[model samples]
Target: MAGRWVKPEVFPLFAAVGAVVGLCSMQLVRNICTNPEVRVTKENRSAGVLQNFEEGEKYAQHGLRKYVRGRRPEVMPNLNKFFSDPK
Candidate 1:
């Protein structure tokens, strides 16, 4: 007697739960294939920008060190120094 289906309301409840789960799973699959959260190209572009910034920082540090040491003049010497006719 206890094994018999005694509650009719449970059928509709189960049906509603199944429909909700099906719709949610479909939406999840659609979102995964159509609209990703992260883009590889954008990440690579940002990484390139960061790398360029770091290189510029290193160059600036070298310039500052050279200036503090007073080893070189502000204006670089002419390239002709290497190719000039013998004195």
Candidate 2:
């Protein structure tokens, strides 16, 4: 003997409409709370600020080295004689 399945009368009326509404509401709530745990780790959030400053100092010194190498002033120039152009 097999048991007969009974479908509730209320289900026939609201099933399609209820399913659509419930799923849409579920998606809305899911999107609202998606990234619920807002967190910034110790390393990720602030590492760049200080690190970039330090790296900038290094880069400045590197450029300074090149500039100083190309254009360097001597200790003293003989002001009296050099003024006269030997033509």
Candidate 3:
């Protein structure tokens, strides 16, 4: 079986399978070429919402500022009372 040519009966089967595969590939190519919706274009491509890194950084900075503004004086009060402590 190593070097034997394909049997005559099997040759027709192989040809039929090859023809079906070729027709399927041709139809796939034609569908891709004829269908505008299936084609890749800039308008159809999704513009990812997270594409802007700088805008995200700005929002983070604004949030941090708001967070710090609420607790700045409460967390870091003036230290002048240390020397004025009555002992």
RMSD of each: 28.6, 29.2, 25.1
Whole-structure CA lDDT of model 3: 0.63
- Winning model by TM-score: 3
Model 2 regions more than 4 Å off: 1-11, 35-87
Each prediction's TM-score versus the true structure: 0.35, 0.27, 0.42
Q: Single out the weakest 10-residue window by summed lDDT for candidate 3.
A: 43-52
Model 3, stretches more than 4 Å misplaced? 2-5, 41-87
Which scores higher on TM-score, 1 or 3? 3
Task: Please list the residue runs of candidate 1 whose C-alpha ends up more than 4 Å from where it truly belongs after superposition.
Answer: 1-6, 36-87
lDDT of 2 by residue, 1-87 (tens): 222333476566668879899999976764454322322565554555443556455544564577777653754445534775574
Candidate 1 per-residue C-alpha lDDT over 7-73 given as tens digits, one digit per residue, 9 for 90 to 100:
7867888789899999999867755543333225655546543435564555446645766685545
Quality of model 1 by C-alpha lDDT: 0.59
